[model samples]
Target: MTAELILKLAGGVPAAFAACLGFGIVFNLRGKTLVFASIGGALGWLVYLLASGFAGDLQRYLLATVAITIYAEIMARVQKTPVTAYLVVSLLPLVPGGGIYYTMRYFVSGDTGMFIETGLHTLAIAGALAAGILPVSSLVRLYGQFKKHRLAVN
Candidate 1:
């Protein structure tokens, strides 16, 4: 996209990294696991930014989630650890916390329109995140099973 978009996304990368790193530390992730999980957050944000150039917010989130899930799966496989640890930490940047806050704010202020709008948007984000995770995770499991079956046959 434009240089402005690139610059903004670039700026966001470090923030995403820092946020994930903080959460990873809180989750008791240490050493390389923590570092790679943080990097996965940065990578997810970068993918979201790049996808934002051509996609709607939901699409961007979906694509970014896909990217992060793939990264988490790969990293988990390489590190021989559970994928949930990396996936959860890496997805912190995209969790739509602000949407939920504003939805609540609107509800409290008696603004039904904004409340409904923001609430729906927030729900959509949660749905998109779940939808994004499902396919990648299922495929990974299926692939693992297939490989195992092949190994057993041989």
Candidate 2:
């Protein structure tokens, strides 16, 4: 990576953290929960930045989503709370808000081609998020179920 890109990524991680912290506050989170959730957002950004070297935009989104989801799952258990708090806040950095905005902008300007491209890209981002979350969540649930069944049998 170029020195400038590295500097931007460094700056971005903290910005992502601050943004998530603000969102967490809006979500009524406080103390350690807020801090950890914010860190998760920074982690997502860091992963995305790192992946930029060898991955496509969609791949970066997928990697970032996976990192954030895993973080949320772990943090939820660690904090003895629901995953929504961490997952929602942490994922703010990776959400396709810009894509959606640009898509709408193109639509409003009668640029059908750009609108179609951005809309499809936005959909693919959503798909990547879902693809990252589903398998990990399924595995976690399956592990919990199998453990519970084994204990009951014992």
Name the regions of candidate 2 deviating beyond 4 angstroms.
none
Residue 94: error of model 1 in Å? 0.5
lDDT at position 97, candidate 1: 91
True-structure lDDT of candidate 1: 0.94
Among the numbered candidates, top TM-score falls to 2
Worst 10 residues of 2 by lDDT: 130-139
Alpha-carbon lDDT of model 2: 0.92
TM-score of each: 0.94, 0.95
lDDT of each: 0.94, 0.92
For 1-154, candidate 1 gives per-residue lDDT tens digits of 7999878877899999999999999999989999999999999999998887689989999999999999999999999999998999999999999999999999999999999999999999999999999999999999999999999999
TM-score of 2: 0.95
Candidate 2 displacement at residue 137 in angstroms: 1.1
Q: Tell me the spans in candidate 1 whose CA falls farther than 4 Å from its real position.
A: none
